[model samples]
Target: MRAGWTWLAAPELWPGRRTAGEVVLALVLGIMAAGSEELLGGEGPRLAVVGIAAVVLSLLRRRMPGTVLAVTAALTPLLSGFAPLLMLVGWSAGRRIVGAGRALAMFSVAFVLFAGVTLQDSWSQQAPMTRLLLTTLYFLATTVVPGLASRYWTQRRTLLHALQERNAQLLWERELVAGQARLRERQRIAQDMHDSLGHQLALISVHTGALEVDPELTPRQREAVGVLRGASVTAMHELREVVGILRDGVEAPAPVDDSGLVGRGTAGIVGLVESARTAGNTVELRSAGEERPLAAAADHAAYRIVQEALTNAYKHAPGASISVELRYEPDSFVVEIVSAAAPAPAPGEVVSGGQGLTGLRERARLVGGMVHAGPADGGGFRVAGVLPYGVVEAAPFVAAEDDFRQQSPKAATVNGLPPMDWTVSARELAGGKERSRAGGIAMGCGIGVALVLVLVVAGGFALAFLVGSMSQGMIDPGEYESVKIGSGEDVVRDRLPNGDTITLMGLDGKGPKEPEGSECLVLMSSDVGDSFETEPVFRFCFKGGKLIEKKSYEVSR
Candidate 1:
């Protein structure tokens, strides 16, 4: 019972401001229909009753569109004045009904009822065959054609909305994938730093500690050694804090062996060059400008950039001569590595993941710098990086995690690890494409349906006009003049044409009043052509079986 009440109180069915507006429109239409009926010598009150009843039923059209359409169609033939209400309900039914089969069934029932009533009325009045055909065409134009148009329009709007929503969802998913990729990259960088830099600092602390206890060391020198040991330990501690920030809550995996290629700043680069020379590689290191201390991140980034470039040179151009240059500008530090032309690698001799250069760029960017790498002037590759002197703090892991949670709560992992795959799902792409295709089909179908409806209505009106013109009742002026005012009804009837032009033309009340206590007959003048201009009409009134009055007048066609 509660559910039933809720259903009844739905906004579409319940009376509110919209209902009030509908009522006002209905009342105005009813008054106009009633006035037309009274002018045409019909019962105005009867037409007004039909109009009011149809409007009342129409109020539920949104909730019970099929029922409303049926009721309105059944009432249409009682008075043609209610036909507009029937058309409105038909359109509402089309928009609200979900499936084509259901709509077809509902509209078919309405058409049958409307046609039956119209045919019955015409048969009772002995209407011509053309009148029956025209009535059927009128029913199609007012109800079925308009209903199809409304259905097409509603479907087009719904499809467009669906497509828009799908496009927005796809865009959001793409952004999420990119964010996850960046988070994963940051974790990788933190792991690399922990393995290489932390290891180097620990070694420094061990070496300094051993030197401080040497038997031959002077007191001041030993004190200096102790300070160096303390500084190394502090650097290691700071490196750990930075790694923690980059790692967020996720523990990085154990690091692989780095093959002893670890150091810091200019000292590290010199050691790296010596190691390369000891490995039987042609290598040179040049430095210029006054050396100055670099920010922690920039120092580490510079070391990694050279390490990666040397690794690439060893792998891709095993025998190429490599030159490493370092420049200290006023505001920045520059590292450039160039390898001379070398023969192409033998098949399977060298394998590259292609992430080395990308990592170089990412490292430089994190330190407020940029990297450029491409083929050198001759053949071998070149990699260069510009790193700023001032420290650029790494992004806060806690804030990033919170932002990720806010943007995509479902994407969070209990282990705090980003998912491996950051590419958009194939299914989502397919779904978007399918929606676009459906929208296109719907648009094409709507345009086709509209064109067909226009053609059908235009053809129907043309046919009706041709039939009406041919069936019009017309009499020659000589025959009308020969019939005196006092002639018998049969005599006047024999002189007239066998049709009622006034009824067919719908010009019943647009003329002078008839004589009192008499029956009247109206016909068209034969001399007047059927066109959009004035035409002469003849009216004859009879009393007591004899013609008492006859008159002629002109009315616009």
Candidate 2:
């Protein structure tokens, strides 16, 4: 009723089903667009328009998807980014506006447009396969296909549920008709038995009463007839009630428990193990690694794995010892259940299969994990599943946000401590420090260029001042000549504990004023070992408290 019925005013229907994919596309576009612009040196009005538009488009994507896509596409040729995104959006819109079948035709045109833009960035179509593959994926996988596939699955599930309900109704009707026929037959039998048997019994009763009154009637005969009459009356009443129930012909459904169903967890698994042991079967449960609050999918998988294994053991092995291990790790948790093979399984002994393993696999996979089941190497059959410990770190929390945050920390460390210098620790770094680490060599290069620029600008100004002063005759011939224009060098040197020379230099236009002198220095962190460098060095004449020398740097490791 929720979906089958029409809804003009419902809020959920309009934005309805954004799909993880659309959001991902928007993110990719934003990040790639931002990165490429920064790579080419983000500046100028054109870059600003495109950058702002791409950001806006990413956030409000679903509302005006085509327009957003078009904006990004138009900006691609003017800016520097993959233009295929525009086509992806165009395809998605065409699928919605016209039809999904038309999506390919529109998307092909979009791909060609992207290829044309790509040509401007690189001359050779040498990486044609790469571009084509990426383009094709963007067109098909990221947009049109996802929307179409989603629709198909949703519709398929709805149709299946409808068919189930209809089948239930049809089955109920057929059973109702069959019961009506049985009830009619029972009614007729009841009538015949009541009419014929009751009349004869009544006549016999009268005769018995006469006999009892007569002195010739024996006590034994009187007692026997009295018992027969009583038994017949009781049978008549019981038959009538049975006839009424058959006549009603409705299923007396077992009561529905509004208390809802109990969910299985660690405790639930323990109880089930205990119950099995009580039935004279041996069962053991073991857990390893740091405990975590599992995601619903993982928890469900764990519960079902043990439940199915135990059920199978009960049906086949009966009294075999079983071991269940729930090993939690940094990245995942493993659920292993082993049960001894049945000594003599009955002919109709049911293997615990059908949907159990399938459901468990699906559950595990849903959380970016997997399941395994096989005969154990030593003896019994084993079912083992690995559930991703930090599934949400790779995805947004769709169902339980609070629970996910609480579990993510310990879960991310399951497999091992992250690679060196990489961690999920909550420690915060200063902005300057973060920039230094992330920016690295490139930042060093930038600082070098900035230093060159600053020196060039300052030298020009210093030269101009000299020129103007000379024009005003403020300097004598010797004064200008004596201030010899020579190559400048500012050296930073230090004596190491091991007695090695550490030299840092600022090289610029050759001038007499540089090198082998008291060079201006800023920060001196000697602990960094041997050397360090910074550029676009600030001087007192060009600095203040509200100042930032915004110079870039290069560091050698």
The TM-score leader among the candidates is: 1
Please provide, for model 1 over 1-557, each residue's C-alpha lDDT reduced to its tens digit, 9 standing for 90 to 100: 74653453354454577556766766765665565556666775676665566556655677788988887787677666666676677777888887999999999898888777767645433235656666567677777877887897788677756754565565567657776887788789989999999889999999999999998999888877876786687578668866886878443332222444335554578766766665557999999889888876678789878888988888878777899999998978899999987665634658889898898877777677888999999688898888887775542212455333233323322234433232344223334456767866886577557756765876777676765764457677787798898989888877776564325354344679988898777777768655657778887888999999988887775
Q: Candidate 2 residues 387-440, lDDT tens each? A: 765545543323455233333332212123321121233212212355445645
Q: What TM-score do all the candidates reach, one by one?
A: 0.49, 0.33
Off by over 4 Å in 2: 1-29, 44-52, 55-98, 101-215, 249-557
The C-alpha stretches of model 1 lying farther than 4 A from their native spots are 1-48, 124-129, 168-189, 212-231, 249-460, 467-557
TM-score of structure candidate 1: 0.49
lDDT of model number 1 = 0.71
lDDT of each: 0.71, 0.51
Count of steric clashes across candidates, in order: 0, 18
Screening candidate 1 with a backbone cut-off below 3 angstroms (N, C-alpha, C), the clashing residue pairs are none
Clashes of 1: 0
